[model samples]
Target: MTIKPLIILPDPVLRQASKPIERVDGELKRLADDMLETMYDAPGIGLAAIQIGVPRRMLVIDVAREGEDKQPQVFINPEILKSSEERSVYEEGCLSIPDYYAEVERPAVVTLRYLDRDGKEQIVDADGLLATCLQHEIDHLNGVLFIDHISRLKREMVIKKFTKAAKSKAI
Candidate 1:
């Protein structure tokens, strides 16, 4: 598996809706593997295909705490089946929006269904950090960002900051 370069914020690619994987072939497996590698290299808990310029409905997550055994999860074409009325706030950061984090409120519990690495369907009942992570990554598949959940003023500021950083990097 190779570590792919992450597409940062202000990259229009991140705003494009991802296409669902029609088949779980070797190529899809390779992409998932690469995504996991990239996530680990970024030292992030989760990553989406669009974050690396691959507009496919794929995501990898490993929220294991430091010192614990690594647990990698691959979700293809994931869909949220249920969400709890209770809300939780977490300081969320994205691999695409490096170095910036903001508190975002999301469902504390959620039921999600998706295809596993073996192409078998699976459903998970998630809460706490997992729920937040799932929502954040899935948002990428739908061309949404966590910043979008924040106040318009904050969202605009964050976008402007990233846009300026991107422009500086292009110099």
Candidate 2:
């Protein structure tokens, strides 16, 4: 698997909704492997296909702590089946957003269903960091960023900062 270049913020591609994976074929599986490689290299817990400019409803997550064996999870066309009324807050940073982070509140628990690596359907109940990560990545699939959950002022500030940084780098 190859490590793909992550698409940063202000890239119009990141705002486009991803298409669902029609089948988990060899190419899709390779993409998933590449995503896992990218996520680990980013030192992040989760990553969505859109972050790599794929624009497909796919994500890879590995919540394992340092020193532990990697437990990679692939979600193909995932959908949240249930979400808790109670909320939990987590400081979320996106691969697309780079260094910026914002505290976003979401359901404390969630149940999601999706196709696994083998193309078999599976459902998993998640909470804590996993729940937050799943929600955040899934949001990317829908063209939503974690900053959208924060105050408008903060969101604009982040966008402006990234936009400026990107411009400077382009010089």
Q: Considering every candidate listed, which one attains the maximal lDDT?
A: 1
Model 2 compared with the native: what TM-score? 0.98
- Number of backbone clashes in candidate 1: 0
Model 2, CA-based lDDT: 0.94
Candidate 2 lDDT over residue span 1-171, tens digit each:
898999999888988999988998999999999999999998799999999999999999998988999999999999999999999999899889988988899999999999999999999999999999999999999999999999999999999998999999999
List where candidate 2 sits over 4 angstroms from the true fold.
none
Tens-digit lDDT track for model 1 on 1-171? 999999999999999999998989899999999999999999899999999999999999999999999999999999999999999999999989988899999999999999999999999999989999999999999999999999999999999999999999999
Which residue pairs overlap in candidate 1's backbone?
none
The C-alpha lDDT values of all candidates are 0.95, 0.94
